[model samples]
Target: MSLHSVFERLAARPWLAAFVFGAASALALPPVYALPVLLLTIPGLLTLLGRAKGWRQAAWIGAWFGFGHQLVGLYWVTHAILTDVAKWFWLVPLAAPGLALPMGLYSILPALVAWRLAPGWPRVLGFAGAWVLAELLRGWAFTGFPWNLMGTAWAFAPLPMQPAALIGAFGLSFFTILLAGLPLLGARRAFGTGGAILAVWMGYGAWRLQGLPPQGTGAQLVLVQGNVRQDLKWDPSHRAAIFQRYVALTSQGAAAAVAEHPEAPVLVVWPETASPFLLAQDPEAIRIATEALPPRGLLLAGTVRAEWGPDGRANALANSLVVLDADGQRHGLYDKSYLVPFGEFMPFGGLLPIRLAAGGMDFSAGPGPSTLPLPGGLPAPGPLICYEVIFPGEVVGAERPGWLLNVTNDAWFGNSAGPYQHLASARMRAVEEGLPMVRAAQTGISAVFDRAGREVARLGLGETGVLRAELPAAGPPTLFGRWGRWIPGGILILSLAVALLLGWRRPSQV
Candidate 1:
């Protein structure tokens, strides 16, 4: 079929268009062709838009499309259900549609923008700009989810996406949308714009890739992946089992590191909540963790810490990243500043139907951005736990660290796409800051990412293993890293302004 005829046929069934578009968007996830998926998002969106009978019709269609996109794209949320028996069955029906419905609202803004701005000649421009604006809203609105963004599809590829350093993940996302929308203009014209843009993006990435050099002799790091079950992770009955699993994994990593790189001391990392019991409160557990570490090595792991305030209630329950020296001495502690909603801290406390489910206690937020000091007094490492990695510009702030360390417990998600999606976000952060990242997950997908966000080594999801890799030293600071989210903010504002200006001028002249 001719391209135009194919578009006409797809546009005939609005519901089919929405479903197909939504499914195509999921290809933006990893282990699939990610960069090309950007090309699909635009056409998928345009087909849905073209099928709409009117503005109100378009809104409803867009909402359904958005819902489908988020529903399938984020189906990994089912892992939350697997965590608690009471919540598992209940969340299966509730969380997926409920989260999708609200998230779909963000998609509506882009549909409305495209419907209203309706650009000619370069239809992709309007669609790309509108979609990016929608994505920006998704990232900022309601404390932001920013998961499964189009840019993340390129997580495994650095050559085309290195531009992320200059514009942040959102900028790369915007360009992805623009490229995706281009095919709507046809092979000749669309290819011209797409090819040129792709060339420029690749060229810039190449320059940045070659120009930057490792700042120091890289550190040999061991990421421990203990395949602990979510149901048993925090169960008091299974606490000993969980502890044993982590210790075994850590010992394994240490042994591997010693055999491979005896000169460089190994830095072993365990995922968030690897130890369910509070280390500060449980002296024995702390001692066990200390004794587990090799004399010349360091251990960085996640645990929960509590402090009783004057209010009598447990005033502070923090999801913390704790560092232990080679002798297992406590070197530094970074409490997670950004806690997950409902999962970590209950929103509005008791008012919401979804109670604070995970972490047993009502978690309190941590203090300002602090970097954990490495052993040799090298550059500090920025630490983020679980949901903290999802926030794009916020995590790696003013003080650019040598590498980003993310410790997560994907056991909550089980064997779903959720873990893969989560890993994609972590990789995007590597690109955003132009810093290497070492992710240690409790369940699996433990991997290492270079400054450009390329996955050098990875252990598959649901696999219990340890990966010992060299952590790339710091390179010249990234543009986004140095200046923060200002660049992406500028692009967002400018795109919206141009869309608005064009929109205003159209009616008066007509």
Candidate 2:
């Protein structure tokens, strides 16, 4: 068939096109296709939005595409549902789809924006601006989900992607869409337009890579994945076993580090909730843990913390990370600021039946980002527990850190792509902040990524192992790290302004 005939046939069923696009987008994630999936989605989304019959039609197309995108990309929701079979039927309809449905709304924003600004402005530019605007909203609206943005697919690629340091991931998303949308313009015989879009993207990426220097070097670190089962992670009966596993893992990591670099201090990292029993409450456990660490090393591990209110109302349970020095003394504690909905804490407290679930909790959110002071007054390290890593611009604050330490327990999602996807998100933050990241996850994908988002070393998902590597030193402060979301927010505002000005000049043209 002719190219024109194929385009006509594909245009006939926008919903089908959307489903394929959504599924293809999910395939961009790890353990399947790598970064190339990003190149596909850009053209796919642009074609769907560009071919829409009207604004209403565009909305429908965007919504279904968003739905399909979320439905497939977030299939890990089924793992949480499987935890409680009693609520399986109800939860699948209520919680599972509800999660994807709201997230899917983000896709509609791009469709609307693209449809409104289409067929006039360069399709590549218009699509890029609209897609970035939608992604920005996805990160901001309703506390945001910035998980798996198109830019994240490049997490494993060799490219430094430090451009995210200047414009943040949302900006990178815009560039990706622009490159992808160029093909759509090419399909319409707009060769010069397509070539220009591709050139600009490659040129900007190349320039950014050259500008950002490598951050750190040769500091030995160990990431311990304890392999704790989700069902037993919080159970009282398994506390001792959990402690033993982490201790064993830490010991193994320390041994590996010693063999590789005898002179360097071993910085052993344990995943979130590596200790089922509260370290603050259990002195014996703390004593046992301290003794397990090397005399001249640092052990950072996650634990639950409880503080009683003056009036004694249930107090507050905090998900937190504690830093232990070589002397086994607690140096500092970093509480998790961004808690996971339902998993870490129940939203609205008693308003929903979610409390009846087995794994739900009432943990309190921690205070905003703060630095954890290292011995000898080196630049403090930024700490994020679990879901906190998903938020792009917020991870590092006004003060940049030597590196980012993310502690997560991915056991909840089992042996699925969830862990890999989570690791990808964590890697993106390293790129976004221009800071190397040390990630410790329970039951899988424990690894270290450089500021460029390249995986320096990693233990595969579902593997029971310890990752021992040396973290690179801190690079110059990233623009996103220093300024947070301001840069991306400005881009969105400017794009909107340009779209509005053009619309005003030619009111009936779109």
Candidate 3:
């Protein structure tokens, strides 16, 4: 009869309540940061898990929750499929749900763990541990698609994102879910504890910012966004025009950047595959590209690299980045290692009889991660292409580079949350590694982040422009950068230990 009773009845229905709450939780992430909504959604999901009679029901509830969350979060995938509707008409409707299917399975482990634990703090803590554990697993399972990690909810602000410098993003997700769950128990002590932790998180950020490193005296960056339409990007007739647009933007931007910082060498960066012709093979294209560079400027542009066999015929292709100088010489080359399944290369050996990528041949994966040495005494960079920037603790190699470079073609997803979310992930990587991130993207969202994850400059989505800014100096390696996955791994162990020990001591009925 009462409002509480009505809400309780709805929450009692695990299938619908879990799905709705999960969908609502995504609003807390970027583009639309509705954080207060989490107070209801997280607590509501915990209540449903606590009420489950068995693991089967709990798992189903979690599956439904994950389905709803991913279905909404990744709806932009449909946009990629819609780019060629005539060829992939039916796929447009299925893209989001299809990707959500496997992603939803990851929720089952956390649900089962939470169901097995006693109610109250034990269940909440255990659920948080299990949730992050699932996240860790999904990050690497089946070639990995670690998009929209729960920690990114805090990515809307730099204050909450500071902890990532110590514990990394996965560790932040652990704390995030743990804090989100405390309210469900309705205890003042738990509430006070969560408040205290939140205060510490914010205080740490303020403290870190106070000692922020000044901008570096290295080469200034000019990020060129051509805003090329996805449909026309690969058209043979438009190839020359697309190439000219980037060259023109580069010349204009480089000149302005040099004028502002005459002492700094300029680095003109283009987005992934910005070059219409094969920059590695075409001497003429490389010469034309170099013409846009300032007297001391260098160009870093993404292009397709061809791998030749012993017989002198091209055997494989690699999505790659190349750095060039005024003399039309290639200084550094880095290929993208992590290829997107179905998008870059077909799975199951192309038995599915469909290809999402442009070319007929599958792209070859590059060796994992490497630091690129630049010319003219510029700081070496760790290059990550496209979604490769989304992975936490995996951005750099043993040889730490002075900065991070991410080149992406977000045009495929159009003007959607996909690019925004991608940018958020890149920002987190900068915070985690204590290195500035220079991100150049096709069709905007081009920006630069300092070592502390502060935005120095940004170009919004759907805009064609160049962002000119100086590179920020890299700080001493953060705790997360030094320890890598071990920090989150330890936290995961401690969280599970707390859950198990407490659940054993205080047994409660479901």
RMSD of each: 2.8, 3.2, 1.8
**Per-residue lDDT of candidate 2, residues 1-510 (tens digit):** 996686567678987777667767777655454555655665766777766767788888888777877777787877776666565657765665678788887777777777776454545565567677777778777666777777666565646365677777777776666655555545664467656755765676677666655555555788888787776666788878878888887887787787778877778888887887777556777787777777667888888888877896447788889888765678889888776666666677556656533444477777877778877554467999987888888887556678999898887777777888888788878877878888988887788887766677888778887888888766667778777777877776676677556643232564
Q: Residues 1-510, candidate 1: write the lDDT tens digits.
A: 896687567677776667667767777766564556657656767756654656776787678778888888877776677677565576677777877888877777777666665554334455566676777778877677888887777776767668888887788777887777777777897889878987898888888878765443456788888888877776788888878878887787787777777777668888897887776456678788767667778888888888887986677788888888755568888888776787886777657757425545667777746677777765578998887888777777556677889999888777877788888888878877777888998888889887777777899887887888887776567788776667866776677676566553243332
* TM-scores for every predicted model: 0.91, 0.89, 0.97
Query: Candidate 3's error at 455, in angstroms?
Result: 0.5
Q: Candidate 3 — which pairs collide?
A: none
Off by over 4 Å in 1: 1-16, 34-41, 47-53, 121-123, 213-218, 309-313, 356-360, 499-510
Kindly give the stretch of ten consecutive residues in candidate 3 with the minimal lDDT sum: 501-510
Ranking by lDDT: 3, 1, 2
What is the lDDT for 431 in model 2? 76
List lDDT for all candidates, in order: 0.75, 0.73, 0.88
Best by TM-score: 3
**Cα shift from native, residue 322, model 1 (Å):** 0.9
